[model samples]
Target: MPFFKKKEPKKTKEQLEKEEEDKKAEEEKKILENEKQIEVAYRFLMQPEVQKFSDINKRVFLRKRGLTTDQIDQAFKRRDEKKESAQTGTEQQQITQQEQKASEENKSVLVYSETLEQKLATALKNGFLSIQKSNTTELSPKIFEVSNLKTLVASQNMLKEIPDAIGNLVNLRVVQLAECGLTNDVISDKLFSLPNLVELNLSKNKLTSIHLIVNLPELQRLDISYNNIVELPEDIEKCQKLQLMNIQNNYINFFPHNFTKLVNLKRILISGNQFEKEAEDALKSTGVEGLFKFLSQ
Candidate 1:
């Protein structure tokens, strides 16, 4: 009984109130930490470093980290919508079939790009920009490090205009802009003018007219299928270095009468387009085994 009486006294009301306030603040801090963790999980989903995970695993990880299935799907969809919107320039494919004005057969022509953002992220890591996230449209005009960047595969993306900044990629050998809804034909013209460009793939775009391989000193192959192209310009007769040309499934109604001038012109792929007169003088110089196997088919 004597030892109990010698124990310390109980805390006062003022001290008790202060301790309560401290406890509340600690709880709030914990809540903030949880929110930060959620953001981390979402960023991991978008990063390339975490892209190897399977789709099901990704969803499971997201759900476990407090993201709903609907929210996760929405996160993945943000980039796709940007590309589709840009494609709207000429042959834009609606995200859903209900938005389509054309029939199912015509709709097949539209290519859906699901990896434009991922590709951009890779480009950034390769010296394009530090794009953590930004407007999905309106590609930045910042200089990209293209040292020997031979193949620029941005096909099926929502790319409308290539900034004049593209001229910096002097060592480009192959450029694939197929089905990206690229309308700025000027970009293609600029691309053709690149001194080092050897192979070009501009298939399934929305071009109405074009200047073909007339004077590309090093150009060896060209593919311009599935567009609104009417005819190849007669100036193509001047490109003596061209070895292969693919003009498949387009709106060509006439063959250039000056075609015979390209003595160095090789394998010509005029299939998939309506040919009124089979030019008896087909290109004979194209290495049948090397340049245009797709055109031959």
Candidate 2:
């Protein structure tokens, strides 16, 4: 008997495509598996908690694990709320306990709109925190300890000067003062020295320039829209970590150089500037060619 003819090798275009797709899928799967393994190994570093409070009512116990104070506080905060909600007459007790905790820790917690000044005064009198925000015009320049505070939001207020004391919040990560009355003359040198600051929102203010906040090392997102910013600082190239900048509705007459220093910039809104022809042409040549709508409109 003649040897059985080998099965005809089938290699159609569809089959080739299928093979390539299968290879890609396999590669992606491997990559995903590796990523998952890496994530599992390092998750502890992402959300460190100082302690795991299983039951605060029983006794204050801290978990001897890799955790930070922030993580621990966050984890227990929700648990405390749930526990209090489940028990009657616990709200009053919680208030007393919170006051005691704040006193002992020498921490500040102020979140009441009913006579803010009065409430802050009481907290300050209790020595829990140094208070600020006495008025819509002036922020206390001696409140935050130049090494503490994590967040500061004083938006929708009428103010022209950002207190030099603001630099005291060296650990600040998020600061939102949008719609505040600010001008180019009201620059604060201390504000630029904040090391941990990441998000800054100064939109809808009377800003006339960008140099005011051009060199924050860790600043990631900046919102300066609705201001009178006509130009950016030449030293803006130094803000290496800046990721997003919104400079809409300003009278930008020229393009700032080294727009390339914004290596991580993913979105830029310049849709309301009065650009000269040369400036407009410059923007179009750069990858930001789409910002022409400002001039067209």
Candidate 3:
């Protein structure tokens, strides 16, 4: 016999294709992992403390952590790209906002061209009214003529009272009376009687209490912060749709007995108040839900 070795069997087409597919899959997986590594390196290098490091020191630090020079360069490249993208987005947003503001100013000049009261009436017809920082001491009774008013803003005024005429705006949804120097006695009970009221902001005032004589079925946001409130009304839980309540810097020591009934409540700011140490600690650590749970027990 001749001294010839037998040839090994060749791989079939299917077997070769399977091997190629597996090799490609593995290469894709490695590329994905490398991208993830680059992302992690980018985030790590962008940390406030790490950003203080010199460029040379940053590379040395990453190298000691098993990152190659190529990965560090990619991370820096990604960071620069993200920064450029963010700057571009911010510039675009600013430009859009400026254009919109200019448009609004032009509209105001063209449409609201009469006396202040007439301008407010025009805005009310458009379902919006704002009388901010105009030395407004009181709301003109003429404003309440618009029954379909949806939003009302009277912020930063010298107004001392909310007239009962506000209740005539049956379709009112939002009311902002912030920084109006209102006292508890000056707040008309009808202010809480609006059927469609959703948001109410009476912040930076001297109100001592929130007396909910009627259920506000649509009320969602209530901001009474920076006020002199002593305690919340037990009927506050009747606002089944209430989501956010800002009662910070009040004198509240305990929650209303039925407060736990507010299942829809999402956030409640109770800081700068007089809650007991245990209650305060619970709120500080576990937030509104935990505080409510603690109070319920």
Q: How badly does each model clash, as a count of residue pairs? A: 1, 5, 0
lDDT string, candidate 2, 1-297, tens digits: 889878988899999999999999999998776555444423422332311211332112122233333444444454446446542222435544854774565433222222343333343334223223424455644345324556667777667688777776677887887877777668587877788878888899887766857658898899988998778887776788887888888887665566655677766766788866555555556634444333334
Candidate 3 segments whose C-alpha is farther than 4 A from its true place: 1-118, 121-125
Alpha-carbon shift of residue 107 in model 3 (angstroms): 23
Best by TM-score: 3
Task: List TM-scores for all candidates, in order.
Answer: 0.49, 0.50, 0.59
Give the Å error, residue 64, model 3. Answer: 73
> Per-residue CA lDDT of candidate 1, range 192-217, in tens?
67787887787888887767455467
lDDT of 3 by residue, 1-297 (tens): 679898999999999999999999999999999898898889975765344334544554465467766787788778768667432112334434544664576534212222354445456448888877666667877678767789988889879689999889989999999999999788888888999999999999998878762357899999999999898887777888989999999888888888889889888888899988888787778887788878978
Model-by-model lDDT, in order? 0.58, 0.60, 0.77
lDDT of 3 at 82: 69
Model 3 TM-score (2 dp): 0.59
- Candidate 3 vs. truth: CA RMSD? 21.1
Model 2 score (lDDT): 0.60
Q: Provide the global lDDT of candidate 3 against the true structure.
A: 0.77
Candidates 1 and 2 compared by TM-score, better number: 2
State the weakest 10-residue window (summed lDDT) of model 2: 50-59
